[model samples]
Target: MEMFGKTLCVTFDDLVGSGVMSKANYKRYVREEKFSFMQRGGNGRKVLIIYDKLPDKIRTEIDTKNPGAKDKIKKQQINPMDHRLKSDSKAVEFYKKYTPKISLDRQTEYVLNVKVLNAMVALEVSMRDAQGKCGFQNNKEIREKVIALCENLRERYRHTLPKARLMEKYAAYKKYGYAVLVNGNSGNQSARKVGPMEGRLLLKLKRSKFPVYTDMQIFEEFNRIVEERNARATREEDKLKPIASPQTVINYLYKTSIKLWWYGVVHGEIAFKNEFMPQFDTKLPDMPNTLWYGDGTKLNLYYKEYDKKQKRMVARTIDVYEVMDACTEVFLGYSFGAENFLTQYDAYRMALETWKVKPYEIVTDNQGGHKKPEAQYFFKRICHLHKTTIRTTASPKPSKALSDASRCR
Candidate 1:
């Protein structure tokens, strides 16, 4: 017999085991020296024959008997669950389980400022649907009710809500609401309406009770208020405001103004009127070589001197003095010394010899050495010989003279 369109053959042992051909038939076949047989194909019956090796003629006979057996084998059906569909609903379930819910209180405050609660609601619905959860599709009525609640909160608290805080709240609400709705059961009927406190309402409280608060101070206060408020209540109706008075504002303004004025007075302007204003009515007559500016400054200093005998060191100080032409800004004379009048006279003599110029006036600050009677007499005699005059400023403002020289340079 044949099944599945394939010829069937069974061994002698197989025939005995299946109780088809008996032992006598098997023995008879063995004595005849023939071990193979063929059975016709029929209803659910498989025929078996025995052969040491299939002969070419038998193989050809089998192929001829079953024309389309290979095609039948290729056409078998596979199990449906074996292949994975990429766009399956499993991803939606995974996200719904892990994503966080938004704070309702925060969202309500945000809606108050933006006045776009309906758009926020729509966004929430869309996000939920994308998560593979049945969105706000319970009915049009429920959606409208939720949207209306957002609008009501906005209307009631619009004045109290800060624009920036409200915006942050809106974002939080949108995110959390979407997560909650996606994972929550619609039929459980917990009044799909979430309140403001549940939404994590953020407070953009005023920077301070005083008007003079800095940005950092204001932010600190705002954070403090938000944390405090959150700790007390999760409901909008339970929220409280810290009181402030007008007197506080006035006091802050007054104090800030006084501080600013004091700062300006301490750090500003210290210059001669003549130095700043060139067109001042009181102008001094030009003195040419008659007047000069003299000052002393440190070039570089040595604190210790090498000791050759002891192979050690000793301390000493050095000072330098120079007289400059007030108009020409030329260095008239300079001296290095630990002594006074002698150095001054030597520097003067060097100036005359080097520049071949004589000064009509000698101007010097009232240092003990320069103001000595002997020095003054020497300067007067020098000025007389040069046909110049002597003049001196009451105080030495070297910085002003230096600035003038720099501008000319």
Candidate 2:
């Protein structure tokens, strides 16, 4: 049978007994030099056939009769469990395809790391060869050396690498170069089960906000569509889609590409901007009183006050609009009321009256009252009336500063 491109021979007596050739015909062929053999050493008149020199028909017969020989040789040659061993070209392909794409510096570092590891393995193998203990056959001494080396490596790397496993890796490193040491899972997308058709259907279902589909709801709806299509299909190949789990649909929704596309559509545009948009650093003024921050918030504490119209004590929480020095975070002015433009106007008036000077800039959020044309007009006229230059208005652009200021207690 074939073993590493070499074939082992069958004996003449076995071939004759198997009825591949008659004993008389074998003798005649031998006499005519049609085939060749060698007399078995110290065995009188016994002969062995050279398999490579045999006719194709005889070789085929021998292989069919002794099918287990190739398997036995392969088992002896290499371990069946070592699946990570790959060809040289495959190792190079994996390294190039899986290396980190975050940046050039990171990719270079990763390649260097793999090269260093592979170099160490090469050094160890070279040392073993120099000591005449690198044989991988049924050699007890070499096996012991390899096992002891594996124990030290196991402690160093915290991995349970057996001798056979180490040798298998060494073999690959010798043949495949440093790329064999690179991890194969860096860009692996083999686990993603959702196909194109299913992805399209999922996105289509996701875009529907009438019922605002949950992951499970979307999966169920997808299943219903697939089933409907399959029921109407006349041929098996015409079936609409494959079966997918609810988690698969959920995973697709959470993917970066899908989230970027659908977040604004599902929630409001403002929410999507807050989550995915980048924020610029707001530089603070150098000195105190140069810049002031203003925002409105509800005070949690409730107070009971007498109401003349109701003839009873009414309990309610009040909204407080406050202004603070951006440099010192010191509160300068505040006004309490049911939230409205009047409270914001009163708060700015209080700040100017308390500070005795208007700030260079006052930043406030675009709340309902803050953006009112009347309120904007009031701000423009107030500081000019006070004989001090001022800037006070809501920013036209969306910003995290507004969201942060609105959370003020």
lDDT of 1 by residue, 1-409 (tens): 2212123343333445555457886678656856554432247434345332345654454446555643453343111111111232432443333323224544333233333433445544654464333112434433444444444555554524334454455555455332222323322223332222321111111211334454345434534564576577767655533213222222232354222322222223333223332443523336656555566666587688887987888875788877777667778888897437877787787777787767776666556387777887777766653212234222232233223322111
Worst 10 residues of 2 by lDDT: 78-87
Q: Write the per-residue lDDT of candidate 2 for residues 199-248, one digit (tens) a residue.
A: 66676677667878987888788888878777887887656564444545
Name the top TM-score candidate. Answer: 2
RMSD to the true structure for each prediction, in A, is: 31.8, 28.6
Candidate lDDT values, in order: 0.45, 0.60
Best candidate, lDDT: 2
lDDT of 2: 0.60
